[model samples]
Target: MIVNSDLTMGEGVIERHEVETFLTLAEELHFGRTAATLHVSTARVSQTIRKLERRVGVPLFNRTSRHVSLTTVGRQLHHELRPAWDDLRAAVQRAIETGRGLSGALHVAFVSPAAAQLLAGVTQVFHEHAPDCEVRIREAQADQILPRIRSGEIDLGLTTLPLDDPDLTHGPVLVREARMLAVPAGHPFARRASVLTADLTRVPLVRLPGHTDIPPRQAGAPPATTAPTAGTFQEALTLVGTGQGALPAGAHARRYYARPDIAYLPISDAPALEWALVWPADRHTARVRAFVEAADTLIHGHGTTRQPPQ
Candidate 1:
């Protein structure tokens, strides 16, 4: 017969190690082997088992010099405690997820044109879905975003993909765009329906800094004249409109700028860019899920009207 005790009636210290030791001994059915597995001496294992039995006020094992077996009460306790321990583990996991600032500040990282256009929509949806969350956005290049994710500097990243890193997790948010040449109204290519990579060879290209990862380089064109400094798509568009040189920007760049002075012409045979949402592989939090869902809704609603880089 077993008597019920109320664990909540008084403060009692139930050390986790005692439970672990009990489970280990139960599995091994031998103190020496169990101690070996636990990296402790056999005497230490015996002491821990004795302590656990005494705490519960019940003998847990029937033992003699030749063999050891569980008492009837011990077998009953094992059945009850094992599942209780499993439930406790699950409860602890849930608590960690809930307590890790699920409703707190979410730091997001993004790039330019998408940052200006889609970010607001994503944030709006996220706020509507998770009203308790506070969001912040940071802008950085495609290459710089992942390192921050690994270091825990940012919660999520919106950028171009094919990261190829095992430590990062990526989800396709929206097909990104290709690098379209933004030219003034009077520029030669502006009169044509579309421009080819070879056409920019002679033009004064207001190219992004040399490190900018635009695709299908102008055939036989000179190397990029300067390093890329314009971090935002808007900055690049502004420079193209006012400067004498032509600049390469994403398809959405034209819409983002909404400038009549400039026109965006596609570059035939250029690589298409992919816009993706990236985060640390280990960061499976509620806030992250909420943010990704909101982003997906916004991009899916936009559809394939914006050509993503292939």
Candidate 2:
């Protein structure tokens, strides 16, 4: 039984069920509908309504054979009680959501240099939203991203798409960079206006390991014969500089990683590199959602429009 704060019951304490029944019936109007809504039988609703009316010493609902409507007292009660109930429910929900939300350190991972740049912007936004929360931004290899997320080593990842995993969910795209070919300055294609996929066979297309398993060269093209070096960003670029092979890269590479020995050639026939935030499907938390929302404020249909190379 609950104390009747609405009505001072000196002799009769109000049962919680009575308030629920009255409010639900008041909203629903029909006894059958109220029963269905409350998952109770029609007889139970009728009995409860009768008991409540007896306690109030008045009719709460006007009933005819065809219809039922709230009485004047019931309307006023509904008006006053509805808002209170809504506010109470909202407060309870907010408390529960806050308790269940992010509380400790969140580890975020990124693969490419472009992803790191995008994540830096996102981190600023995330901090503004959650100033107390610690966000650890870590550089991760392409292959290490999803596995680390699934293993709970990382909370989020910023990586490329065509991520066909059922275990992960990808967020809004943060960048769309044009594909560029990183060629040795000594190569002929490096001087071309724009390179085509057909021109891939004309040079040794170096394969950088730890890529998302997307082929380094177009299908059926001769495999890269550039002397295989340990898979590292600088090592691959060094090979390109030595005229060992040309490498497919994002347009951002030329801007940030520009080198005197390496030339970035725009690939006219290649698709753009799309980057988005990704997280474990089962581990989607309030922090992850908030980070995605923060990213949306920056990227989704907003000011960070793609600017072609100058």
- How close is each model in CA RMSD to the real structure? 11.3, 12.0
lDDT of 1 by residue, 105-199 (tens): 88888766555456666899889988989888887665577788889899887776567789888776465576677877667778988877666
TM-score of 1: 0.58
Model 1 local distance difference test score:
0.71
Clashing pairs in 2: none
Residue pairs with backbone overlap in model 1:
176-308, 206-246, 209-227, 209-228, 272-309, 272-310, 273-309
C-alpha lDDT of candidate 2 relative to the true structure: 0.76
**Model-by-model lDDT, in order?**
0.71, 0.76
Look at candidate 1 and tell me the lDDT of residue 283.
Answer: 86
* 1-310 per-residue lDDT for model 2 (tens digits): 2233343434675565677788888988889988998889999999998988888788989999889999998898789877876676677666555545655667899876767877888889888978877889999876688889889999888887768789999887777778788888877876787887667666665666656422246777665444454376677788889877777777877887899998888888877777778898877778888888888787754566544242
Stretches > 4 Å off in candidate 1 = 1-49, 52-95, 98-101, 127-129, 140-144, 164-166, 184-186, 204-213, 217-235, 242-244, 301-310
Residue 9 Cα positional deviation in candidate 2, in Å, after optimal superposition: 39
